[model samples]
Target: MQKQADRVVQILKSKGLRVTPQRFAVYANLLERLDHPTADQILNDLNQDAPTSSQATVYLSLQTLRDAGLVREVLLEQGVCRYDANVEPHHHFRCRCCGKIEDIEWDAFEGLSFRKLRAGLKVDSYEITVNGVCDRCQH
Candidate 1:
């Protein structure tokens, strides 16, 4: 836990952000859960042990963390955003039946890049979401 805390502090300092208690709580939650939770989901889970923590606090913390590049948000669908603690490049596989998000690590694809036919086009990152029943859901 101390190592994770140190990492959080380092990230905040490197990004010129303050490492506040609320921010740490939010970040620690994301790191521990690894579930790619929505804002509401994060609030609910945090409330279990932190009843005084407000929904707005969670939102603000999430936004700050995202802005600092310590966390990443993936828009899986319309009006739905999921928070990911893993900032490293990777793909996500969503289970259509259960709405479960799974990370697919393919380092080979991380360096993949392509040129656009049109001018002034650039691709910062790549994404490939396989929408289908995952193995567990199929069984």
Candidate 2:
């Protein structure tokens, strides 16, 4: 809707990035989907709405959004990248049976001690991806 587009524009402008129609459309698509989507998937959905974007534009928009810390990358498989709109601290769970990814509450691992690591390896930020059959798949 117009609200989503305006919100995307606000965030992009706050980050001092150029707001192109293609970029806004791509970002709007990302915001609407909870599923971590790849650039190709985003493009396909965008094509359904407006079929004027190239794959490269999607990729560039994703890169820009990630660089601005508005989106996060979910790299579970080699050469297969997914995009997450939830930039807040959290982990991920991947359903092996369905290849679905869901966010895990970051507080669940609150007590994890990074001090247990070997010397000189400073810990910054990390994301844990739990792979297993999800609840729906277990049925």
Indicate the worst ten consecutive residues by lDDT in candidate 2: 3-12
lDDT of 2 by residue, 1-139 (tens): 7886777778888989988988877777888898899999999998986589899999999998888777888898779999988889989989999998888998877677888899999988888888899999988
- Clash pairs (backbone) in predicted model 2: none
- In model 1, state the lDDT of residue 59: 94
Report how far off residue 84 is in candidate 2 (Å). Answer: 0.9
Q: How many backbone clashes does candidate 2 have?
A: 0
**Tens digits of per-residue lDDT for model 1 on 6-106?**
98889889988888888988888898876699989888887896586788999999999998888999987789999999989888888899888888885
Lowest summed lDDT window (length 10), candidate 1: 108-117
Model 1 TM-score (2 dp): 0.86
TM-scores of all models? 0.86, 0.89
- RMSD values for the candidates in order, in angstroms, are 2.4, 1.8
- Which candidate number would show the highest lDDT if scored against the true structure? 2
